[model samples]
Every structure is written in C-alpha cells, then in structure tokens.
Target: MTEILEPENCFCQLASGSKGNALYVKGGETAVLFDCGLSGRELERRMAERDLDPTTLSAVVVSHEHTDHVGGAGVICRRFGIPLYITEATRTGSTKKLGKTKAMDIQAMECGKRFSVGSLEIHPFSISHDAADTSGFRVTASSGAVLGIATDLGIAGHLVKEHLSGCHALVLESNHDPELLYANPNYPWPLKQRVRSRVGHLSNEEAATLLDAIDRSRLSHLVLAHLSEENNTPDLALAAAYGVLNGSNTSITVAKQNLPTPVLSF
Candidate 1:
C-alpha cells in the first residue's frame, strides 16, 4: 500500500516587508492575490516559480493605498485582465502613486461587506492605519477553510480580533521590536514616535498580544509578516510568536522581504 496526499488549499507569501508585499491564495477554482506590492514582472516571476498561473487569477485585492501595498496593482491587473478590488478612496488616493496605466476593471469594495471572486468569499473589515480606507480581510475558501490577513495595521482591536478568530491560518504583521526600534540611533524621535503610535506599525509585543487574544484551536499555520528590515530580524520575530504559540500543533514561519515563502497547503 502507498500513502496518498490530498490537494488542499494553497497560500503563498510572494513578498513581505516595508519595501513590498504580495500574497497568493487559491481555493477550489479561484485564485486571488491579496496585494501586489512587488513589480508586475516580479510578481509574475514569483508566481511562475511557485507553479501558479497568472491567467487563472480571479482578482487582485488591495488592502490600502500605501505604495508597499499597492505598488504593482495597476500593472498586474492590466496585464492579467483581472479586476482590481479596492475601496473608492484607495483608488482615488492612489491614482498618482500607482502611476498612469491603461484602464482596468475596478470593483468597489466597502468595509464590512462580503464579496465573491471565483471560489473564495472575502469579507473586508476596516483597520486602523494611515491610509484612505485601510482594510483587513477574512477570506473563506469553498472548502470552509478560513484565512485571516491583517498587516500594516497599527493595532489589532476588537474588530480585528473578531474577524481573525477561528481562522485556519493567519498572516499577521509583527513589524518591529519595541526595544530595538527605540534604541536605534538612525531613526529620529518623531519618526520613532509615529512607528509606535496608534496609527503606526505593530510591535512584536503587540503582535504577540493580539495572538494571545485570538482563538488558536483551529489554527494550523501562523505567518509573521511585514517585519521591519532595520528594526527587526527573523529570529526575533519568530521568538516573539513562538512565545505565544509554543507547544502547539500550529507551524510558524516568517515572511521575508526579498523572496516568496514556500507554499502552505491546508
């Protein structure tokens, strides 16, 4: 007798960091991207390397209007002929930043609304971030597996905790280490203050606090994303999350700045 494996849901972190961000998620017949912070060429290359077809992508979803979150949105949508799902304010605020590209299909997504793209159902929720209309997502696959992604958020509040609870997998931001960030002489006082503010990135402690509050019984995978290159390291971020998730069945991984992570299947 031979062992067999099942074809499960696929999730890949194509890139993550202050410099860029992109994610690829597929369930059933639907393939979607959460963000396209990388260049169009880089995103395509990474997807190809991961054996994912760009033509099969159902849509490109935007989380906010930040350059690191929407840098490649316009180009990727135009190239793949896929619709760009984003808030009206995000589109309006990002027009000049996303640059002048050919017209592409745009779908307006409001906070707290549910929308479907192929075999996945996405629920967008407002998050506290310095953007036109920042959002976090709770995506459910046709198979009932759920993935929660909340990055670039200053704080993981009640709403974020509510949406992220009971997820099969989570990609959360652990952007900085408070001690390291505060000690770094390179960063000015005001810049440091902003990074620690309510509308700034989450510290390692903050991310861990959020994890402590969320339901982890159903979680199989935990990915720490959007780490600050200058203020954090993979080992530090991993330790912070491990402190909260140690001795659990869940597997943890860190999303890096320069490359895509191995595809995680549920």
Candidate 2:
C-alpha cells in the first residue's frame, strides 16, 4: 500500500431543484461555489449549516444563465470578494439575474476550456439545456481526484459520458418519473411536453440509462439531483439508479431541493 498526501476532493449540494441550485466543491486549499441559485443570505446560511466558510471561497462559477443557477452569483462573489467565472454568452444572458457586478471581478470561461482555481482544475463541457451555454463541470484535485457535476441537463449523450467518465464522485440529475409527470393534473399538456423535451430535463429512467453508459468502476459517491417535488419521489429516483447499479459498492444519495446534502469526499 502507498501513502497519499494531497487532500481528497469534496463537494455538497447546498440546494438543487427547479426553484434554486447551488453547490460547493473543495480540493485541498481551493474552494469554489459551483452555483448560487439561492439568495446570498440563503446560500451563506446553507454553508453555515454545513460548517463551510464562505469567506474562503476562491470563485463563484456559474453553469448557465438560468435563474435557478445564476440568481445569486453576483451577490455571493461581491460579498466574498471572489471572482465570478461565466461564459460570455451566459454573462450576457444573466445580465438581469446577476444584477450589478464589478467588471474586473468577472472572468470569462468558454465551454470545453480548462481553468484553474487554486489547487483545483476545472474543465467545463457543453450540455443539452434550454439555457444559454449550459455546462457540466469536471473538477480535478491536485491529487487526481475527480468530481463530476451534470445536473439540469436534458440529454446525456456521448459527450456527457466522455466528460463524466472516471469520476470519483458524481452529481447527476434524476428530475422526474414519466408516469407521475404525465399524470399530474396541475401541469398543462404543454408543460408536460416541455418537461420531457430534448432540452428540458432527465427522467428517472433516462438518468439510469445514462448512468449505465458512464464509467463507474471507480465511482464511490453518486448523488441524484434536481428531482421534481411534484413529479418525482426520492424512492423512485433511488430505485431507478439501484437497478442500474445493482449490488455495486457505491454510496448513493438523493439530493433534496431545500436542504444540503452531507459533504461527500472522493
């Protein structure tokens, strides 16, 4: 056996769903906010609940311009004196949601480009989503630990698998169950169609199918995220994933929309 030195990468979903989304990822001395969909005050409260310090954040990286992903991006960056990392298209699309932000504090990041934030290296890849230039992030710690995040994406194709492959931990979306989504009386026909569209969200079965395509031999942590409160249940999401990951030695969790998941390390 060999001794390892560098710290393992760790992450937690502060909140995830249609209402809001946010996550914190840390690798060694580097810590970053992957999204800040909640208000600055609420995001800080969630961090506090998890014993994480917002002052230590290196940057706030946005995945897209959607309100559920970028609503609090500007406030969090400003409050913590951290830089805001976003693609140019996303920056333009988020103008209103991000509110006022210092031009100098914003760093432009293109999809498929790699960027550094302290000891962590981030690779952003494009994803199928309705938002402007949505991305799925692959974060690698200096020690070679990898954390993959691919939530809020509609289609998980070869590219998604390529980016998600070999991850130690993954936060993937399992948005809804087709039966429930289709049967919901509150949702109109158009809304149902949109929910299952190519650029909408992943159903539980679709998530399971996508998981089967990705490499999970070394995967230790898997969190199913962005579940619909109205259309899906944690049990349904977990059941779908369990079928694909049957008897696998992996810790699976269903992320909540309002509460933070416990910190998961790789």
Candidate 3:
C-alpha cells in the first residue's frame, strides 16, 4: 500500500476594494489567477511573499471592466505575456480603458461555458451588476474540491444561488449595510440609491441572507469580500452573518482591502 498526499488547492485575495481587486488560485503545480487589478510591481511583491512566480502563472481571468477589477490586468498580461481571458463585453470596456496594447492578449470567454486550464475546470456564471457583463466563477480542482467565487452583485438570484451550492469554500460579497449607507454623510442621494439598487452592490444583510440559504454542510471556509470603505465595517458585516452562523459549523473570515488573508487550502 502507498500513502497518498492529498491534492492541494487554495485561493487567496491579492486585493479587493473600490481601488483594485484580484484573487489567486492554485492547485498542484498548476495555478490560475482570476483577476489582475493591482499593478504589476504590487502583484509581483504579493506573489513573491507567497513564494509564487508570476511567470509560471497559467492564465489571468477578468470578471468585468470596472477599474477596481481590471486596472492592472494589462500590466500583468504585458509583463508575464500570459493570456488574458474575459467576456466580449469585458474586453470592450477594458479596451477603452486599458488600451489596445493590453486588449490584444485577451482570449474571450463564454459566460455560461465551463473551460479547462491545466487541471482546473473554470466555470464563469453570470452575476447581476450594472456593468455590461459580469460573472461569478466556480473552479473545480483536479482533486474534486470546489471553490466558488462571487462578488459585486446587487442580489443573488436563483441562478446565483443554485450555482454556488455545495462548495468547499467561497468568496462572497458583503459590500455594505443598508442602514450604514443611508446614514453615511458622504454619498449624495442619487449615488446612495444606486448603491442600494438592484443593479448595484449587495448589502451586508443580503450577503448574510444568501449564506443562510446556502447548504452549509460542506462549507469549510466562507470569506466576506468587497467591503465599502465609508459605508461598511467588518464588525457590522460579521454581526449580520453571526446570527445565522452561530450554531452552524463553518469558519468565517473577512477579506481586508489592504491586507491579504492567509491562503485557504481545500
């Protein structure tokens, strides 16, 4: 009989905020990065800290064209010469902002199709947002472990809920609290309404409610991502999910805008 090493699959947030966002996923010797929002230098520094080399990264996937998500995409693609993957809508918007130089490397992805990269199966599912075309993803590793990544949705519909069920780990958005948004002194009325709109961002309560509806039996790690700087706080987001998660056996962590949380192994 031979002792077998369990397959290693992990996800880590490189950055998440109004400024920029990225998530790095690795399994075995094959690794795929989901987004590249931070600058190439910053991305290099983070990768080095994790003992990862950017040149060895398999591919870079884009969620949408928002500056916070695609700001550093071009830089990463250019620096490493990695193929950039995105939907046609995302490519159009990215082209306008990131320019033709970066857009040249983009490989368009079908929103509902599941594609393969090394040993990881990448599925890009549609997510409701103000952007032209945005998606959440489910990456199934060769070891049979699944990781669900979703963010920047105004509401999680049947499509979103059904796709996210029974995942080993998740990076879900808990962007803001409704009350906090209303009382916040900075945002004007129109901007505030947009933030609370169905096409805008999800409130902390919404995120919590979605978690409650999810089948948590197989859930190991749940990370609350994309908090608003002015309108949300970690304590409040934690409190929103605390009640539902109190008796449930699951580990919850908050993803900071500035600091990287420890890589979660699945």
Candidate 4:
C-alpha cells in the first residue's frame, strides 16, 4: 500500500529583518506572497534558499504602496505575470509610482471583501494609516488554519480587531516605543507629532493593547513586525509584548531586520 504524506502549514518571513517586511505562506502546493518589500535579486536568493520556485507563487497581495512594502512587486509581477491584488485606491496610488501595466493583471478587491487566491481565502480589512487605502489581511489556509497580517497601522480599529480575533498566527506591528520616538534627535517636531498620532504608526503600547483586546486562547504565534530602526529596539518591543502576553501560552518573536525568520508552522 502507498502512503500519503500530510501537508504542512508554513509561513516564512522573506524580509522581516528590519524596516522592510515581506512574507510567504504555503499550504501544500498553493503558495501566496503577502508583501514584496525586498529587491528582486534578494527576494530570488531568499526564495531559492527555501526551495521555493517563484513561478509557483499563486498571487501577490499588497498592504500599501510604501516603497519598503512594494519595492520588488513590479519585478515579480512582470516576471511571472502574476495577478497583483489590492484596493482601487491603492491600485491608483500604485500606478502613480509603478506606471500602467497590463490592466488585466490587476485584481482590484474592495475593503472588507473576502476573496480566494488558490487554496487560501483572504480577508482585507481597512486600517488607520497616513497612506491611502492601507489595509491588513487575514488568510485562511486550506487546512482551516488562520493567519493575520497587520503592520504599518496607526491604531487598531474595530475591523482590525474583529478580523484578527481568532487567528492562529499574527504578524502584528510594534513600530516604536513612545519614549524612544519622543527622545529621538533626528526627527523634527511635526514628524514626531505625526508618529504619535492615531493616524500614524502604532507604538509598542498600542500593539500590546491590541493584543490585550484579543482572545488569546487560540493564539498560537505572535510576531512583532515593522519596528522602527532609529526609535525602537528588539529588546524593548519584546519586553513590552511579553508583558502583554503576561505569561500566556502564546509564543512571541521579534522579527529581525536583516535575517529572514524560519517558516513558522501551525
């Protein structure tokens, strides 16, 4: 008798090392990319190391048009003719920077809509941020496992919390510590105020508070992401989130700036 192999649920941080963020999720043969924040060569090298073939990617879902988030998007899209998905507002903004491509290749999804990319179901929720049409996503794998991707958000909103409530894994933001940002010498007063506002980035406290609001019973993995290079340290972010976890069974890790995190299995 022939034996059947079980498929594993895996998520890899391709560029979660520093200011930039990108992730790859695989459920059996169906692979979906979360963000393309690195250069094409770097992304290629990293994927190769993981034994992933770029042509096998199902689709690319973008969160926003920040250069760090979309740097390698154009290259990958054109290279494989992959479907690029985002909101209409984000698509418009992307065109302003990326220029017109094959319109047929762009899949425009409305906020709060649930859609499928291969075997994965994606739910895009609106987030408060300075960018136009910023969003976070919840992905449901074929195995019924759920993963939430949220970063570069200002404060957690009703939608974000509701969608993120029951995920098995979450890539949540821990952008900066309030004290570190306020004490930074490089930022001007206006920029400092912007960072502190509800429409700007989430502070470590805000990230922790968001976690506090969630139901932690089923929370398996929580990765602190999109940390500020100048204003935040991994130790501080870890400490704050650890305090929030308060000795819960949930596991936590600080996504590093230069090294890709191992594919976390659920």
Pairs with steric clashes in candidate 4: 17-256, 17-257, 17-258, 18-257
TM-score of each: 0.95, 0.96, 0.94, 0.92
Using TM-score, rank the candidates from best to worst.
Answer: 2, 1, 3, 4
Residue-level lDDT of model 3, residues 21-73, one tens digit each, is 88988877778888777888888888776666678788889898898898887
lDDT of 2: 0.91
- Native-referenced Cα lDDT, model 4: 0.81
Native-vs-model 3 lDDT? Answer: 0.84
lDDT of 1 by residue, 65-136 (tens): 999999999888888788999999998988976665447888999999999998899999999988889999
Candidate that beats the other on lDDT, 1 or 2, i.e. the better one: 2
* TM-score head-to-head 1 vs 4, winner: 1
Error of 2 at 44 (Å): 1.1
Better candidate number, 2 or 3, judged by TM-score: 2
Off by over 4 Å in 2: 1-7
Put down candidate 4 lDDT per residue, 198-256, tens digits, no spaces: 77888888898999898777788888888888899989998889988877878887777
The per-prediction tally of clashing pairs is 0, 0, 0, 4
Q: Which one wins by lDDT: 1 or 4?
A: 1
Please give, for residues 70-136, the per-residue lDDT of candidate 2 as tens digits: 9999988877788999999999999988877654399999999899999999999999988889999
> Which residue runs of candidate 4 sit more than 4 Å off their true CA positions?
1-7, 17-19
Clashes by residue pair, model 3? none
